[model samples]
Every structure is written in C-alpha cells, then in structure tokens.
Target chain A: MSLESGLNQNKYLNLSSSWRYLTVENFDKITDEELVKLILENQENFLFLVRRYEEKLTRYIRRISGLDKEDIEDLLQDIFIKVYQNLNDFDTSLKFSSWIYRIAHNHAISNFRKSKARPVTVSMDEETEIARRIASGIDVLKEVDQKLKKKVVIDVLKKMDKNYKEVLILKFLEEKDYNEISDILQKPVGTIGTLINRAKKQFKKIVEKEKIDF
Target chain B: MSDLSKNVLEEIKEHHITPKPKWEFLVRDYVIWAMFGILVLIGSIAFSALIFMITNHDWDIYRNLGQSFWQFLLLSLPYFWIVLVIAFSIFAWYDLKKTRAGYRYTFTKIGLANIGLSILLGTAFFYSGIGMKIENIFADNMPFYRVIHPGRGITVWENPDKGLLVGEVTGFIDDEGFNLRDLKNQDWIVSALNSVWPREVKSNIGMIVRIIGKQTGKDTFQAIEVRPWMVNCDRNGAPAVQPCRSLDRERKPFIPFPLIPMPAK
Candidate 1:
C-alpha cells in the first residue's frame, strides 16, 4: 500500500513498513540507522520509527519530570513532533537512541523549568529498581531491608541538585555508559565520570546526614 | 496503537511536519566552525601586534632611563595588547566548544591548541607588516588609544635632559632653528646650528627627526646630533642610518640600528 493511504488507515502504535526496497524483515530487526535512512526517503516511515521509541521515551520523561500522565503524554507529542522536524540534524555518528534521549532530556528539562515543576521523584514502577541499582553502586549491604533502601534512595534523590540527580539517574537507572551519557548530555566523557562520582558522593552525604543505617 | 502515538501521527499528517532541509543543518554547522576560525584569526592579529611592540622596543636605553635592565624591560612590555590576546584566545576556545565534537577535547588541550595556532600565525603577521599596520591604524584614529599606546619613539627620545629629543619638525625658524612637535604633542624650538645632520635628512616640513641634545628650556632643545626618527637604535643612544648598515658607519660617534629600518618619508 502507498504510504499516504497507510496514514489514512489509522495505524499508529503498530505502523507497517511499506518501503519498496526494504527487506520484509520485521521493523524491530532493522537498525535505527537503516530506519532513519528509510524515513528520510519517505516521511511516512516516521510512524514506525516513533512506535519503536514511544513507550521508552515516555517512561524516561516520566522518570525525570514527575509530570502527571496527561502532561507527560502531551509533552511526548511535542517531543516527537520536534524529532520529526529535526531528523536531518541527527548525526549518524551517534547511536540513534543516545541522540533521541538527548533530545528528550533537553526538552523535559526546559519544560520542567518553565512549568516550575520541581519533580524529584521517579515513577512508581522504577522505584524498586532504582533503589537496588543505586544501593549496589554505594555498596549498601544486601542485608539491608529493601523497603528502607527504597526510602533512602528516593529521599536522597529528591534532595540532590538537579545536575547530580540527572547524571545518577542516567547512569544507574537508564543503564547508560559514560560515552552514551556524555553524548546525551553533550559533555566530555571524562566530565561524565566526574559527575557520576560526585553524584554518588552526594547520595552518601544525604544518607549519612539522615542517619539511614543502610 | 497507544493514543499518544496516534495523536502524534495524526498531527504529523494534519500539520505536514517534514524534517528540516539537510542544507540548513549543514549551514549551521559550517557557520559555527567559521566563527571559531574567524575568532582565532582576530586573536592572532592581537598577538602579532603584541609581538611587534615587544620586539621593536629599544631595550638599549635602559641605562639612560635610570632603571635597571629588568625594570626597563618589564615596564615597556605592552600590557594592553597582552590582555587582548588572552581574551581573544579564550573567546576562540569557547567557540570551538560549540562544534560537533569539540567537547571531546579537554580545556587545556583546546586552549593550548588555540594559543599555539595564534602564535604561529601571529609570528607570520609580524613579518608581513600587518602587525605594524594595525598598530599605526590604532595610533592614528583613536586619540585615547594613542595616549595609552605611547609611540615607540616617545620612550627613546623623552629624556631631553639626557640629550634626547624627538618630534616632527613642524616649520623652520630660519637656518638656526625650527618649529617642532614631539611624540607627546609638546611644542619645541629645535636648534640645529653646530649640530650634526645626516646627508639624506632634509629640512622637510613634516619629517619626524630625533635630536640628541640637551633641553636648553621648557620648549627649546639644542641638537648635538639630528637623525631620522627610527625605532631600532642600538644601546648607546646610537641610530642606524639604514637597515643595510649604511657605508657611513666610518663617521665618528655614529651607531647603527639593525633588523628594522625606518619607513622612508
């Protein structure tokens, strides 16, 4: 089917690839680089690309922004629109995921600042994983109560500076490496390591100050 | 399909949002690099001017200035231009950070790179005479700049009591003396009778002549020796009649400046 007709077909989350030259592999199997190339050839292929990142980006935005579901969804809509408009600006040298995450991080931060939403909380589902991840980095003994660790992690994250918290979240929760975090934040890799170290130190300071016995 | 993704696609079709043209991003990237390069060029010009000022200064006159050699050297260094070179290098280094992969380089690395390029290009500028041209432009156009940027001749010729006076011969006051305006804009009556005048130097209306004689009065000077206003005099308060080591060095008490020649009037 022609791409224009597919747009009229109301397929949003599950967009089918209609490019004549692309192999009939499932869209999930195609690298983001190839997908970007296809999208450049035909704008209709953007929907399939968007479907790949929609849920992940939504979760990322929610983790950082603490905005309500509706606000997060609305912000996602704008963010995707921006992505579509700047597809040509995407540098192929960067992993598409890192570039997209960078865009999402910047947009979320600016909107968070403008709306005056000082959101220091991650969403509910990410809480347990975040606690476990941060605790491992800080060497909090496995014997420590999981519930107590979660409380300490959340409280410490909330009190830390936005810069430190953002690096920590990207490093521990998102599982981004130093280079990926550097690309996403537009900082040197060396600086990323320093920031992560400083963030961990801040976490230790907060837990110590509160006398949390983890 | 989730509703949010559906809405985004619907809006994409409704508003027809297309990826911006590749040329636009390319232009933006090139503009950033171009700005970085231009800033470095300007910084080099400032550095070259600094090089010219420092190297062209007559370090030989320290004894006449009644200061130690180190004190004279330190006092004559061009502090204003030094600050400008530093400021421009910083601006250029910051501009480089805006480039696509500029962040990969450390501050010390990038800073040293910018400074190194500036020095290399600045030394070239010093030779091509662009440095002196820029200095003269500032000297002629900006009165305030000229005040802070004392003429090179002013230092060597300021101590009239030490038999040093330099200025433009404004007009002749008959064969015995002439009207003069020194580099500091001070007026003087220059007496050339019983003074030594070089063969090539004429009593021109606007010639910048140097007089090595005692200051006889507040606005009068006796010329023991009169030579062209030159910048590269050697340490004994001597002037080089020409950069080529003029054939007249055999003349008694004659000293020669080297490496630079005064621009012919």
Candidate 2:
C-alpha cells in the first residue's frame, strides 16, 4: 500500500468512537477528584479514565524505544495490569493523569532496558524492503515517485537518536504544551525548554550534515 | 532538481516522518479500554468490601480480625497507590511511543506528568485510609489501656484520707521481710508510691475497699486492691505505675496514698 494510504488507515483506526468522544469532551471539566471518586464508586467507569490518557501514554512510550505496534501493545497491557492490581492504593490527592504517566515512564524505561538486552529485528525495515521490491516490479515511471522520496525521509528519521526523534514528533506532530511535556518527562519546565532547544539544534545539524534542506 | 533544494525537501520529509502501526489500531484500543473497565470494577468491589468490613466491625468470626484488618490496610494502602502510579505512567509512555513523538519530548512530558499524578493520588488514598483507621480505632472503644509496670508485682493501696498509691518491690521481697533501708531510695520503691495507676483502674483503691466497709487510715494499705494491667499476663508484664512524667520532679516522687477508713483506735 502507498504510505499515504497506510497513514490514512492508521488515523482512521486510532481515532475510534471512544477516542472521538474523549477528544470532544473538555477534559478540564472533569476534575481528578471526580474521576477518582468514580473509580472508587463504580469501577467500570475507570475505563473512561484509561481511554482518556491512553493515546498520550502510548505516544510517549513509542517515542522512547522506537518499538513497533506489537511490542507497544504488549507493554501497554502489562502497565494496565499493574495499575489494576494496585488501584486500591491510589492517593486521591494526586492528579490521576500524573500517577498513570509515572507508571508509563518507569515501565517504558524498564522495557527499553529489556529490549536492549534482547534485541529484536526492526520490522519497519522489513516492511520497507518489501515495499521497495514491490515498487521495483511496478512501472519504471512510478518507481521514482514522491512516495519513494517519503520512504527515504522515514528511513533517515529511523536512524536518528530516539531522544531527538521524540522531541520532534511531540513538538511538531502532537503539538503538546511545554508544561505537558515537562509533566510527562518529570523534568523541570526549564529543562524541557532546554532539551527542546538542544534537540532542534541537533536535528538541524544532523539534517545539514546529510546535506538535506530545512 | 538543484542539489540544495533537493536536500531541503529531504530534510522536511525526514522531520515529518509519521508512525505506521503493525496491527489493527481500533482493536488494540478497544481491548485496552475493555481490560481497564474490568480492572476498575474488580478494584471497586474489593474496596467497598474493605470499607464495609472496617465500618461494621464484623470481625466476629475471629476476635482479632478487626485489628488485623486495620494493620493490613495501613501496610497496603501506600503500596497500592505507588503501583497504580507506575502502571499508568507506563501506559502514557506507550501512548507517546505509538504516536512516534520524539523520546525526549514524550518521556519528559509523560514521566513528570505521571509522577505528579501518582504522588497526588497516592497521598489522597493514604490520607483517606488513615482517616478511616483513626475512626475505626476510636470506634472500637477498647478503652485506653496501658500497663504502668511490666515485671515485678505491684500492690495497690488506698488511704481514705488521701487518694491512691501503688507499691512495687525494690529488692526482691524475701520470704523473711523487705529491708526498709534497701527499699528507701530504690527506683521501684520511689516509682510505685508516686505513679498513677493504669487507666483501666478507674476507681481509687480506697473506693473499692470502702464499699466493703474497710476502715480508713491505718488499714488503708491493707485495704488496697491490685490486679495485672494487661489481659494476657503470661505474655506482657504488669504496666509500670509511675507518677505523671510531665509533673515537676518533686511532685512526681510522691503519689499521695488515698486514706481508707480508720481502724478502731
């Protein structure tokens, strides 16, 4: 499938009915206290809480390790299981989002360590190779299309340090606020600002070395 | 295409690289949400049950179950919040990853957010649990029981004219007799005469004997009644009876013995 088509599919699938509902509702209206009380009073509604934060959490994890969908899904499951098992101790004083995000961070770090120890083949490479083969077999005129150029862009991004890549994605793609970024990373606001600055500079340098334009 | 322009286009493309999922994204999200719902349900039921047990004090099955429940709640509450925080944080990280946000950006944001959330939530749960425990403790109405003396036996006495006094041995009370000189300045002797009896001993010794028509003054010491402070005498020693520690040193040394009815003069 074309890269455009693939992204379209992802967008369609990720923006499920539940997600749409969450996105439409202003999350600020529902206080953390209310959410916690709901969890305590009716556990079933806790799913809403999970859904509320899942996308952001998943995005955070994916950026850190560059793990594919399967690994990310498995890790996400493990994290929830842990949260489920220990929900009784959740302190109502804290923001519910912050608590869950902390869990995500630790689990991601641990998962990264494990992934480093037990290396897995990059499935994206395989997919790209297959795409290349398919494209080579197609009409010669179409083989040198813009789609192929996009693939090359993806390939270069894959080679960048995971840290630099994450900053770019969150800033340009996710459009998250600096405060939100700071909260997710457990860093001071100043530190996040600094990291973003450094990341942009490093990214620019990398592209320049590759003789690529801004 | 000019080399410079081509390079520029390539860089922009690289910067805009998007994530491609390997699985059906809808199904994954559904499964996660479903699982979360189930977990919350189970947790709520368990939490309610715990609250019920604590509030009702339905520990008839085992006499000590009530105490055990409080202990378990105290020990487990902190750990529960911590685990929840960690798990949710991981979930956030995974979400960030799937979106292909850069590692530094995603992790920094998610990590800080999660930690803050966990601490806030955990603290709230802990305080609530603690509050419940305090309420339970008071509700039990077990009586503020304390042992004034632990080991050597103490004899409680009441002089009707005075109030109440407890006497514990200095040196061992030999079969022959207690040596007055050796007992004079001993800690036990000094402590016993002065200290307030355990809270369990509500009535002064004089009152107990007075009801029996015991004479006051001379018969005061003999009229006094003494008992072990703790329920399980075999396990815990008698509570030490000492003057109120907060009192002035001179005042603390002498607990006025209650006057009993005087014997026929």
Candidate 3:
C-alpha cells in the first residue's frame, strides 16, 4: 500500500474497538525499549507514546512559538506531523526526548524563516540589568504592571532573530541549559554560549528602545 | 546588568505560548520512534559481536585485536572524534551562512549520511584493530608489574623507599603495587629511574623502584629503591621525575622524574 494509505489504515485500526483496551497502564510497566518494540510491532499504538510526552513536547513548542497564537498552533501541528511521518526512522540509542526536541526546534526555526520576520535587536547592558532584576526578584516589576511588562518583553522578543529568540525562550521560559540548547540547535556548546550572551545584549537594546517602564 | 533587562526574563516566562495538542502529540511520537531505532542498532551490534566471539574457538585473535584497538583508541580516539565533529560543524556553519534558502533539505541528508558513514567506519576500525591486537600483541608475552606506593596528592616522589627500583609500572598504579587489573581503570605513571625502558611504563609510584621481576611471595609488602630517584631532565630544564621546572619561566613548574606528565597540564 502507498505510505499515506498505510498510515490511514493504521490509524483506522488504532481507533477500532479491539485497540480500545490498549491503555497507558499496559505500557507503563514496560521499559522504554520494550515500549518501542511494542509500538514497532503495532504502529496503531503509537498514539500512546504521543500522550506520554505531550506535556514536555508542548512546553518545548511553547518556547519557540511566536506572538501570533494561530501561527504558533500551525507550526506546532506541522512539527507533530513531521514527527509522525519520521517515526519509523527514529534512532533508539539517543534519548527519545532529545531527538524529538531537535525536530521541534528545527521546525520552529523553519517556520520562523518562512514568515520572514525582521530580526529584533535588544540592548545587552539594559537586558542584563533587567535579567538581574528579574532573577533577584527586585522592585523593578513594581513600577510597571505585570501584564504590560510581559507585553513589552514579548514584543521585543518578536523582533529578535529566530536564533536569539529561540535561545532566550528556551533558557528563560523553558529553563533549558546551554548544553540542551546546543543539542537542540545542533550548534557547538561554545557557539551557544556566545549566542546567548549576544542575545541578551540585543534583548536589552530592544527593551531600552521601547522605553517600557521597568 | 540593569533591573529593566532582568525584568524581561520574568516577562518571557509569563508570556510563554500555549503549545497546541496536535504538535505535542507529534513531537512525542517522533521521540519514541527515534529512541527505538537507536536501541535496535546498538543491540544488533553487540549481539553480532557476541555471536562472532562464541562461534570462533580462536578467541586469542579477538583479544589481541582488542588490545591493539584500545592502544590506538587511547592514543587518538578522543582527538579523532573531536576533530571530526569540529570539521563537520565548520561545514554546517559555512553552509548555513552561504545559503538563505533553507539548506536544511540538502544539509540534513548530507550531514546524516556523513555522520552515519563516519560512525560505521570508526566502529569497523575499532573492532578490526582489536582483532589485530589480539592476534599479534596479546598472544605474545604480556609484561606486568606492581606499584609500591601511590604518591600523595599530585606530588611526585614525595616519599621514597630505599631499595632496587625495577621497570616503572606504566599506565595505572593504584595505592597497591601494579596489578594487571589496575590497567583496566587508570593510566600509568611512567618510571623515572629507567630512562632506557623499552615498553611504555603506565603506572604511578611513591618512589623509584627496581623491578626484580614478578614477585612470587605471598606478602604484599616488598622493598624497592627510594630517594635520589633518577630525574630525567629535558633541554627546557623540566625534570622527568619530580619538581621539574619549564624552560619558559612564565609557565608553571612541574615535578620531575617518573616520566609522567603532570595531570594538571
């Protein structure tokens, strides 16, 4: 059967009454390796795997999503579809989570490029102080309303380059390490470090230009 | 760092986009499949190796090959892998910089293929080298030795036992004498006394010692040479044994003797 037809047939089989009994509990006891084997044996059961990592996957997606809600959803859906199609080719030696995150990062960056958004530059000096203030839980936020402050940050991020934006989002929002971001971006650890440093600077510049009350 | 810039961090966290359900599902599925493939690949390799060893009565060949493979690996494996990764990264970076039209299509295909080929070749080379070492080197006589004492901290030749100092136990020397098993875990400190030693000394010791060949006695304590350990010095004035200073005055001083480079270096 054609690949598309095979997928449709598999999905139908998955939704059939016979498959309804295949619950999360059934696979919970199995090791990841064994669970994968089961999924390979029955492609229809792949949906369970989807449910398992949904929270983490969503968090990752959220980090790269732009300000536009619809665009974010569309990009996320596209990433998932790609993941579904590539399931059979997945390598099990690597952590299943990291591999998926890599895909998500790639997809998000690609979507960002297609949208052709202008690169945003935020001042490093200002952003660093802002970052410190946020980290220190100081009175900086007291001056500006929380919602308005958030809008300012989001607007500034939207204007930044996808590279900078992704790193900032992953680091600040998702709280991923430099190493994790490096893996996701497939960039060297050193390069990621430098990018993060520069990203913060650019972010600061943008924040200053906007003159959002800190 | 200013207070305003720091506030941006909190703002970013508060304004995180809500991930769509469909995308979340897709990401999860991809992860599962990727993990499955990797596990299968590793399992297949290990299984094949095991089967090959069991079927072949001549296990000696495998042993020798493994030794040679390990030697080469120790000498060059880390450097090789690092170079390969750096080279690939450079290529990827250049490709990305030169093209604006999403080189992902070509880049991913070529990059994956290159990586796959490199891994396959590396594994083949490793196994083949192991086989060669087993057949040639391992089959021959394997010299062993003992370490009388492991020096305190990083200090070389701190306490020397006055006695005959044998061939320096190279590679890894534990607190006890050089045992064959120690080779498994630690790299040895080369002997400082025997400058003429042929095979590489791979163990560390408290003092220089004259190896009287393998000790047959039951007692673990054996007497060996101690102080005034042969300190081999290079043109740079750095001693081969303990407390060797570098020719460049700016560089930090090192201990002389024992032929082992300082770990801090």
Highest TM-score: give the candidate number: 1
Docking class of 3: incorrect
Candidate 3 global CA lDDT score: 0.43
lDDT of 3 at A99: 62
- lDDT (CA) for every model shown? 0.76, 0.41, 0.43
Give each prediction's root-mean-square deviation over alpha carbons: 9.5, 20.9, 21.0
Interface RMSD (C-alpha) of each candidate? 2.3, 18.0, 16.1
- Please give the RMSD of candidate 2 to the true structure: 20.9
Output the lDDT of residue B226, model 3: 22
Top DockQ model: 1
Return the TM-score for each candidate structure.
0.76, 0.32, 0.36
Highest-scoring model, lDDT: 1
**DockQ of all predictions against the true structure, Cα-based:** 0.49, 0.02, 0.02
TM-score of 2: 0.32
Clash pairs (backbone) in predicted model 1: B240-B257
